[model samples]
Target: MKNYNKYARSYFMPPKTSMKWMEKEYVTKAPKWCSVDLRDGNQALIVPMNLAEKLEYFQLLVDLGFKEIEVGFPAASETEFTFLRTLIEQDLIPADVTVQVLTQSREHIIRKTFDALQGVRKAVVHLYNSTSVAQREQVFKKSKEEIIQIAVSGAELLTSCAAETEGDFTFQYSPESFTGTEIDFALDICNQVLDVWKPGVDNEVIINLPATVSLSMPHVYASQIEYMSEHLKYREHVILSIHPHNDRGTGVADAELGMLAGADRVEGTLFGNGERTGNVDIVTLALNLYSHGIDPELNFERIPDVLKVYERITKMKVPERHPYGGELVFTAFSGSHQDAIAKGIKWREDNAEPYWNVPYLLIDPTDIGREYEGDIIRINSQSGKGGIAYILEQTYGLDLPIQMRESFGYRVKSISDHLHKELGSAEIYTIFEQEYINLNKPIQFIDYSFKSGEQFETMIEVKKDGVIHEFTGIGNGRLDAISQVIQSQLNISYSNLLYKEHALGTGSDSKAVSYVGITNESGTIYWGCGIDVDIMTSSIKALFSAVNKLILDQ
Candidate 1:
């Protein structure tokens, strides 16, 4: 903060205005996605991936539906060179996919890049050189005319190499730090490279403008991209591309806005892994389009599987809060969020909603192989009645009554608060079983037989305080008759008994579950649950469960 005054803006605004990208609402179509994970992302890692891991990661990129992937700077290392050879030698590169290799404006590196591409069906010979003013002054110490010659000579080298090469080749050029370079100079270098390649419809060149160091907001980058898209030679044949770094934590924004500005391709890494803050997150960008009802053309249906392999090979973890691919991105722990999500899920099922419009969630977690029970609503001290009840009903098929749900919710929250940790579904269910269901103490159900007469007659035997007793009472219903017998014979006074029963599931082995609530003189209601094979027995047990709760509390 103290040296903020010394840090002036390094990025240059275009000399001409190109702001039409602001009119577009969102990206409606998928771009030519190029995963630079092996080259750009791999270089950033402290422990870079080896040849085997690189191969596995490449297959993952292919499976994710990327048509273009920058395999590596083959000329930079023996391992990278061998890896490129391995793909070609083994016929691992698909027929439709093109592997791109990076090289500088040098003869030997360019020749060795072509050497690694031998026997390949198709490949991109990428050439780059730094053109930024700061780089020219401090790093390369080259004038604008000299810098143009470096790119021109490299482009010429690529054309010559491709003429003698065995495979079909496409040419790509990048002004290494495009954003920091003046917009006019950026255009000049790219056009010079395009002229050497002489691109046509059949052989389009990719002019990738990288935010080598993201120096401004995303809008500025978009304007710069628009300026190139408008002025670049062979505009119809060129695939305008952007490689945005996350220095400002807006690489996705830069890519999205760049596409809106008429860039045709995006070069990024999965989950935005690369040098510094990393490349634009291709997964986020694609899925952003997906949530807007556009197909990203990339397969993210099993994001977990992708993440597992990525973390294992890259030795980097996707943050728990990372969009779509994170462990806790879809998980709700706040009471209000959980409640709304619970209601939203039920609303969808009840209405048979055809679209995803859940309150807090942008897309259904299941769309990416995440579930509602464990992944959507997790119970903690902050959980609410709706979420806890939803978890129970969705998981264990216990549709608790509304009042009972409120009472049970408090019990769960209190225990979770005391434990100072979140409770898993199994732990929550265990608590339910211990605290509410089939509680037998001070009063217990020994046996019961129900008969229908003028009113329902019940012959019931019960154990009260370790004593066995038998009594009879008649009322309008069987439960009423049992209640009358208990109140009179055992001298237990309770009223406003409410009961509900349901079949746990549809099967011969399925049992009946019943819930009971009894209000005492103090205006407090005690709740209980019972599960049995017979409906009548379950109800009787339920009444005794509530009675035991009332007695224990008294």
Candidate 2:
């Protein structure tokens, strides 16, 4: 707060106003996505990736459907130059994909950058010069005219180089810090480059306007992009592009709004990795469109694989809470959120909805290699009955009765709260088995033989306190008969027994799972579960489980 006097707004607003981009609610189509992961992302790493890693990353970008990828500033380093040459000399560059290389306005750099592109089928020779007022006054210490000449000279050099180059080449010009530059000056430099390249429908030039430091809000950047899109010379021949960094944490927003403002392409790194705060996240931008019913054209179906490779090569961990890509992004830990998500998932499965309208989830996690049972309804102290029950039904096929689910939910929450940790599906299953299923503490099951006559006659043998006993009882059903034998012989008084059963799955190995609930003398409820190959045995076991719970509590 005390340093407020030191900061001032460095971004410039366009001179005229036509806020047409504000009218669009969402992006209707995917932009031409150019991944700068190798160039922008690599440079930002604490330990920049080696040549081998760069090659792997380049291949990954191709696999992910990037048509244009900024490989590196080939003229800046031997590694960068070697990487470019490796792609060309090894014939790794795909015929359809174009590799773009960055270069400054200087001649030798431009010349060496051009040399690296020899034998390539197609390449983009990108030229850039800083045109911001701050760069002019402080960094470059040059007048506006001098800056314009630097860009003009670079354009001229690219023209001469392209004439002699062996590969098919396209020109791209960026007023590097476009957002901080005056609109008129940025427009002038780009048009001058266009005048030299003479871009047409067949060879459209990309005029990338980069928010190099992201000095303003996203809307201001959108207005600047609109101004550039409207005023750039040879409008139809230009692919208006934006490269937004995340200094203000709005890179995704800037790219989306810029596309709505008539820009045709977006140059960003995956997961927003780049210098300073980093470039816009192409993954988020693309998936945003995908969630809105538009095709992003990029395959994110296996995002975990992508994340593994990205982390291994980049040496940067994707935050657990990062949008779409993080591990816990789809997981719900809050009770209310879990409940709604559980209900939403069940509704979708039962109704066969055409669209993804799951609660709290913008897109189905399964659409990107995440599961609902394991990844969606995570259990913690805040988890609820719906979530616990959903996990049971989805993971283990143990659909508890509603009342039993509520009772089991509180038991799970209490355990998780005491342990101070989240419970996984397997852990929850273990707890269910240990605490409720087929429990025979204090009273144990030995043998049961039933004969149906005027009523159900059952003879059951049980062991308690190292003693074996036998009892006979009659009731309307086998479970009721067992309950009557236990209450009458053991004096374990309980009533209002409720039971439900279903096959765990189909086929010979399928087992019956039964749940039982009973009310004790104190009006307190106890629940239990049983699993067995025989439905009758499972129902009997469930009754005993409920009795064991009641006895243990008493």
What tens digits encode model 1's per-residue C-alpha lDDT throughout 460-547? 9878778888899888998899988888887889889888899999989999999999999989998889999989888888888898
TM-score of each: 0.98, 0.98
Off by over 4 Å in 1: none
Top-lDDT candidate index: 1
- Please give, for residues 151-235, the per-residue lDDT of candidate 2 as tens digits: 9999999989988989899888999889889998898889888998888888888899999989999999999999888999999
* Clash count, predicted structure 1: 0
How far residue 150's Cα lies from its native spot in candidate 2, in Å, is 0.6
Candidate 2: where is the Cα deviation over 4 Å? none
Minimal lDDT window, size 10, model 1? 435-444
